[model samples]
Target chain A: MQIDHSENIVELKNISFAYGGKNVLEDITFNVHKGDYLGIVGPNGGGKTTLLKIIIGLLTPSHGTVHLFGQDICCFNKWSKIGYVPQKATNFDNSFPLTVEEVVTMGRYGKPKNDKIVLQSLKQVEMLEFRNKLIGDLSGGQQQRVFIAKALAGEPEIIFLDEPTVGVDLKTQEQFYRILKDLNKKLKLTLVLISHDIDVIASETTEIACVNKKLIYDNNPENFLRSEKLKKLYGSGVKFVFHTH
Target chain B: MEAVLSLFFIHTNMFDIFQYGFILRGLEAGLIIAVIAPLIGIFLVLRRYSLIADTLSHVSLAGIALGLLLKINPIITALIASISSSIFIEKLRINKKVYGESALSIFLSGSLAIAIVLIGIAKGFNINLFNYLFGSIVTVKQIDVYLIGILGMVVIGLIIFFYKELVYVTFDEESAKVSGINTNFINTLLIVLAALTVSLAIPIVGILLVSALIVLPVVTALQFKKSFKQTILIAEVISIVSVFLGIFVSYYLNLATGGTIVLIALGIFFLSLFF
Candidate 1:
């Protein structure tokens, strides 16, 4: 048998993580393919963020082998190929004296400075007009857009967002998801979004991974909504209203 | 007004101050610090490590006191003490056993206590201690000038080489780490550079007030709406002007040079609030 390595951008095998001797993730295994929008959903403290951290190499898994872009993660040095927006983007210090353009330019580090690419990223997020404005002066939703623009500035093949809409209003969140969906479809960019909203995960993502200290379900989002795994993960009286848009 | 300005400029007394070698040396040292202090301070303030500046300066004071008691070069000793303390602070921060500010306060008080005890043992408040405490740039030797110049160059050179990395880490450590930046190395290097800056500054800025040089100009610039790069440029300008004018005024008024410079910076900071 032959394997087509180009299909998969990320591969994980028997990954587990423990904090202070308590297990947060257990023997998790999954693969993210090129251009796939993967949504990871789980309960609070269920290790969704930790799993994303492990994938991004922010946290080292206690046990397992991981590969990115067909190379072992330990030896992978091409980090510009992927972008990460951490969970604290919404809570970044408001007084930080950085303009939007400067913040976005950080994403292009180790690469030659390119004003055009920076402008393109800002334009993609509809924040081009505010490029010269200080990040502290922006609203929460606007700041979120700027952070996404920062991640996009690098032109990465994959972008990982950990609760990108945590502090965003519901109306803005819908718009935010629309922009993400557009990026995935138009740019063919791979996305790995860790979110707690089950409905959003089921409706927006192409694939869903229900994680609760273990891999509960990993399949198409539609099947995930129809399955009983979500109820099992959340316990009795759990309700999920799936929306198709 | 123009005639009065011309008469003041032509007065021989005004030009005589710039002719003295000690005054010239003091100006040189002050100018170098004016450039490097706030350059490092912007990152320090942004990362919320401004208190570390104060802590390291106190540690350098203890080292200076010890060096004086042992008949050694105080600046070298101060550098050693500050670098070691910076390393320890980084260790404490990573350990997560103590709060960051608590770690800083511990070092701050510990070093200050050591300095006071040593000062008492060395026969209480000597001229040498006073000079170090309030800064006597008039006593700045040629060797001190060379050392400060070299150290300032190293700090500026390192910052230029690691500008992007430093900015990335300061803005967002977790994201920078994920982006393949060696965040631990950068963090340690930043603390080390900050320690070096404090040590280099002590001879001219004094132990009690070195952080003012490192922090005040940046804060003043923060009052303006500007890009990070622009803020740094404005901060450099503010620092340079304040240092030169402070030294000039201190010479005429016979005030402590360090305190004068810091007061000028404070004045600028307050003025910026209204803008």
Candidate 2:
């Protein structure tokens, strides 16, 4: 990993949050550097999404400080600089009536219409051909790509994707990852993905962390599976089944 | 020919209510609805809060009942109470421990109870029922015109200034907030706009047709367009034409004004559905 003494892309410290009087995240601390593909994995309700929200300045933790681009999040004014592809969050209405081009163009909401940005982002995800197709008419995977294109409209340096592959076919998931990999390599954009698929994370991400309430950073997946910490996380019966080197 | 001619030369020669003032007032109110309804409708429809639109209008029924029971302006009371109810919905949405639909249903039924109670106690409602259930163009005075005009400007101004935020929050709220779109403020502002638009429109289209005005045009517009600007613009144009044509036809045919407008809008929406 190239360690540049430059800006910390995302930083959260001692973050604490709760929903329904139950602790969702307690003492969550992590830092994501520029060009880091940090994949977060944890069981259901383990605060993976909550952590992403904190980093993106979406939800304010009960107690914590979040810094984006090395500035205090509360005071940071550069919002258009971040691209976020929230979980497909859209239902298949079949009649939604919006074309892929229009959906992708939504990413440039606050910025000047950058055709180049739109085209490049689509090409990065290899969805340029379907830019004119209606979103409701696309397959689950293709629709996900349009959404990814929408998030990339502003050409943000850091991208946060919260479960981008949720509820899609396995082939589509692989295709989505291929697009993501191309973008990460070509643009050098810092990618933070929240996922439960450890296999995908193992193959794709340079930095992988196991998060549940608190975050342990730089814990090599190899080292993690060997240790007893993961068994406790996934329960005694569940063990990490490694799929790749 | 006579109507259009009379519109241009009415005040100088004619002295009847049909002169320009009545038609102008109706046209003005319709114009305001044309602008406000589609935007609010987009949010309401996206959030599956179309029922809230129904609930709000029903609640506005009680509000209008309060105004009528007190022998005052119903639109104003509706504006007040409907906005309050919308805010209440937002507050409940955040509580997270409670169900949102339950909040909407409780408020809806509670407002219905108030409306029924008020009607029972108000001594037969005095034939002014159409003003609440089916709006009249005649009830729109000069003051109502100015009120609609001003609120229309404020709603449009706020929407124009916050277009991106509104769109972001509407489609993907979590991403919107993550990208720093101030979802709370935007959500409240949207509900407030929805309440205000519904309240103001209730006076012209009545509660039943008001949600139609807010939704159908946008639904029609969505059939072809994708960008918010294009979608809203087409819906506005359709609304303007529908309102204008509906008023002329209603006035000439002696039919109900609000019903005529909504029916015409429905016709346009149906036309958009064909190949």
Candidate 3:
């Protein structure tokens, strides 16, 4: 596949990061274009989420430069343009007395609450009926949908999700991916997803970036599956059935 | 007929107690503190930072002791000490220099130590110190009432201004930051408001029981599992009721104001648990 540097929305050049003496990511270069669905796959500690955090400016790399929307990350203040759904979205104190609508309204923090936008976001996730319900009362799958709605409430052009489907049921996971694909195709929203389900993510995303403490593979999913890079990251005997649909 | 008459008579006496200037001043301050404490309390309780109130209260005690030693207005000194310490605690928590609970415990005991030393230097506890320690309603001066009123409005106004951001940060801080909210500024603002609320509350709830005023009503309101706004409103109602009833009952029965208020709040909590 041919690459177009002029249309790049995110550019990371020679990024290296370490925690104390341990190097988590080293000399990584990647770019995400507008409206691209990029999947980042790696082992549990392979720095997939760390890379995502770095792109979002949550963590600074020890070496390298990150440019978001053609501007240096340090000078990039248009955070509303990029939405984020962190890992384990359910890890918050569920019993916190917040309604689903209240949680969604948080997407527009530092601004006046807008019921129309909140309702619209909820409608996108089909969670409008549960707006008045307590956040903790919903099932795990339902909660994940609400979080997606929350990210959507900001009307972001790009969204970065880290392990978003963890602990959800299989059917819900398929539905979740469908919703994401719909958003990407219909709204032309850029998505950066981190996942462990190699087969589904392989078939779902437009491009794949495999990491094992480094950028082991970066290209179209067809080449990723046809190539021998999966074994290099997941090791020998790692079996995966590439779903046609 | 006799029970009905006695009930009416007691209600009349309750209203009549407001005639005294000190009682009026105390009630005004107590009402304002009632509103301010739980407004901040709901956020603190939701964020699992309820201990911040207790830690700041202890620091306020040291400030009060310092004021007593120097013969200055204790409320002003307590205000300075608590606001400063609250900022320090927030920074320590943010910088990861100390575990949050460890920091709270350290400040709690360290400030108490300083307060004890100051009390000793001032020749030990006196009538004034006792009033400050346990809360004497009649001792609430007119100037304290004015100060409380001004600070109470400031706290309430800030909460109103930062309502959405505060709720967002309390619910999920990282996401709030991701969405362009300056979470550190919001957090610091909250702790500073908490400091002001605690210092103002000291004159009514006293050092030892001030946390109850800040925590109990909110916890009790949490029992209903209402929405965030509803929970805060319920907490305000519960706090106002407790403060008013406690002040009135203590006046008639000659009881400690802080203890009486806390007991009423505890009673509400237990009742909610039962329901």
- Clashes per candidate, residues 3 or more apart or on different chains: 0, 0, 0
Tens-digit per-residue lDDT, A1-245, candidate 3: 34343488889999999998999999999899987899998889889999998998888999999999988998888888888888968988868899999888887654566889989999998899999999999988899999999899888879999999999999999999999999988888889999977877788899889877888656688677667877877788877777677
Model 3 - which docking category? medium
Q: Residue-wise lDDT of candidate 1 within A93-136, one digit each (tens)?
A: 77787999999999887778999999999999999999989898
Q: Pick out the ten consecutive residues of candidate 2 chain A with the lowest summed lDDT.
A: A88-97
Better of 1 and 3 by DockQ: 1
A145-219 per-residue lDDT for model 2 (tens digits)? 878887788778888888888889998888899888877877787889889987788788878778887776663
Task: State in Å the error of residue B102, model 2.
Answer: 2.8
Number of the predicted model whose DockQ against the real structure is largest: 1
Residue B248's lDDT in candidate 2: 73
Question: What's candidate 1's DockQ score?
Answer: 0.79
TM-score, one value per model: 0.95, 0.86, 0.95
Compose the digit string of candidate 2's lDDT tens values, residues B1-275.
47654653654443243577878788888778777888778767767777778779988999988998887788888888899999988899887656888888888899989988989998668657666688777778788888888998888899888877887677667767766677899999988888888888887888878888888888888877465566777888888877777777677667888898899899999999882
Candidate 3 to truth, TM: 0.95
Greater-lDDT candidate between 2 and 3: 3
Which residue pairs overlap in candidate 3's backbone?
Answer: none
